[model samples]
Target: MRQNFILQVILSILIVTMPVSAETTIYRFTKIIDGTGEALLARDIAVESGIIKAVGNNLDRSSNGNLVDMGSLIALPGLIDAHTHITYGLPEAPKGNAWGELGATTREQRVAAAKRNALLTLETGVTSVRDLNAGGGIDFELRDAINAGAVRGPRIFTSGPGIHPANDPSPEGTDKTTPEFLKAAAEKRIESGADWIKIFGTTGSADDLTSRAYYSAAAIKAAADVAKAAGKRITVHSYGIEAVDAAITAGVTSLDHPVGLTENHIKAMKAADIIYVPTIDHNRYYAQHSEEYGYDSNVRANLRVFVGRNIETVRRANHAGVTIAMGSDAVLTGFGENTCELRAFIAAGMSNAEAIKSATLNGAMLLGQDNDLGRIKVGYTADFIAVSGDPLTDINAIISGVTAVMKEGVLVVDHRTGGKVNKPNCGTLY
Candidate 1:
């Protein structure tokens, strides 16, 4: 088993190093579900130099290129995880068996752990991610590495760190955090090459489910102004409705993890075009793995109740025509289960098609890459995943059925039979 794992890692290295060529390649699928619609069309996708050249029925074979016939597999645009902490923790077991394992490593170990996470994240078919935070400029560096082709992982758009009182930059004269301090933190993140700014507008997660507001409406608006002036997007994390009004008033690009939103907040968010990233699955993950966090029975029960409230909030939002994006809020044990949030979307009275869109077009729109990343259309980047079942009928087909993956026209992961391939998790992990 050890020898096979070693060989698969070596093979993955070879595949990642493979060069791109101008020669066209064709991938024929049983059915292709473009993110724009509800129908699954049987189509062939042609690629060259990592860009989709053509997508149609029975693509021409006159141009000499490789042709891969994906038997009994359906295709969908590669998924985008709108919220993640990909750099926060390691996928492997901790050196010590406690939640501190999340932050137990040194700088070097953190970097190494992040690299492992990058690969593992790709193994789950997430081609792009909007990482919410990784303090100390680590997320920024990871994004650069992946962009430069030095790392074999998902495309990362990161916020280096969030504007939180827990970190430095508090007001010198008073104990309370001010608008200036928050705005300055946003500027620093933009200066650090963050594509997005994260605002820790509420204090909740892990064992506690309190919905305390971390910033005033003015402070959040000040930070939002900074992000807009710098041409960067911002997302606010609010556990409940405590920070929703402030987030809406600030005009944040998205709001994460908020539940019990009032009718006013919902209407305002839709009016402002603010996307909602519910991230309902992360709490479920913590509740399920209570031992790791030393979460008591009460905490677990609270988490379960929170998930139900979050899903109900989503139902109301969806009914009101507000945009919803899928976000797993993946950390520690949550990397491979990144797409699990789609299940929550389905449970929230969304059809399977709508749930899939939250990960595809909806997520791409939130990331401002709708044209290139969301659909299997001509002239788009060839980033997609193939699964054994059609996601239109069952959301799990997209969540757990990804069998092959391509990023920028490179066949990075293939887990089909005779798939003697890929990483620490390899074929078995999928």
Candidate 2:
């Protein structure tokens, strides 16, 4: 009796600690945009253990898994939002002030906002995001929760909080504005398992669009050096041209929200190979929803003007061979419209294919996830969305037409008839 009891205990322990096996599934689509401007028609993909095992037609015969035939849907690599502050206050609860509305959010509000944004973002077909502006180290907690499956959200590559001065309210707390202090701050973020270091390079946002240099070149360079030493990438948020030169010198991985760039600045960015994330549509969102934030008409008008400037800058940058990536800079009510930045990219002279690449391929490259997250190629993760129309010709097909979303081989959201994942002759395809 004692021997049998001991054997049962050991078996129970083994069962409890055993690794869970992943399912292999086959998904057939009408067409596929492979993220490299190549569209494969009538493609069937085999996903084994959440990774693409094969991609071709007639994969059903050789593949052994659940077959889900997405009928007449155009498949594409999952979209990526290059910039967001998903942890900010809720969109439903608007408390707009002079210019410091974001600073007054409570911890509870911040966490709740993140939770809501996560589901909305996933359903919108964005599989991954680079969450930049956050406070109180909440971004790290949110990222970890998503990775551990405690929360349902897009894959997050976060920079815990940016290095900024005391006056910057988004990141909470005042900091010594010295280079050494900035370097220490970067190390602290790395120790907290932050994926990137961010520098608030300029002072301008919301109704105020000034591009005054917030940090000196030495300070930005110091943080960038620390990030590089820790094998991490760094980015800068410069609302205008004032800090472009310093960002270039710091060798940051990407520059966000710079407008009114001279030809020389564009040339420098191109030569440095720094990616420019022109988030023109974010201004549109802010302006369109200005009433929600208690913004007067003048503030709305200013936002529209900024959007024009942003678009103009992107036109010049894209024409000058500067690599451009799509970033929504989504906050508050902007979560669902995360991919709307693609429309602005098109307006800035990028073709539909080029804009799609910015959100998929370029975004994955920016996150250092090009090998795993951006394409439908074999060996990449099975993260793709089924849209209703051909995104190659019409950009709105992706911007507003994502019908079904699959993340890691799991059908998370399906907007077909009757609110079901399996459509008629689609899911459960024998």
Give the best candidate by lDDT. 1
For every model in order, what is the number of clashing pairs? Answer: 0, 0
User: What is the Å distance of residue 246 in model 2 from its true position?
Assistant: 0.7
By summed lDDT, the worst window of 10 consecutive residues in model 2 runs over 421-430
lDDT of 2 by residue, 1-430 (tens): 9999899677644433332223557777888898875796437777777777777766655544567888888899998899988887553656555125656667887798898998888877898999996878788888889888899889899988777775233344654666787788788889978898888888887677888887778878998998998999999999998888988999989999999999999999889889899888888887777766778888888888898899899999988989888888888767787887887888889888888888888889898888998898878988999888898888878867788888887777788664633211101100
TM-score, candidate number 2? 0.88
CA RMSD of all predictions: 9.6, 11.6
lDDT of every model, 2 decimals: 0.81, 0.80
lDDT (Cα) of model 1: 0.81
Please state the error at residue 11 of candidate 1 in Å.
Answer: 41
For model 2, the superposed segments whose C-alpha errors exceed 4 Å read 1-23, 95-105, 167-177, 420-430
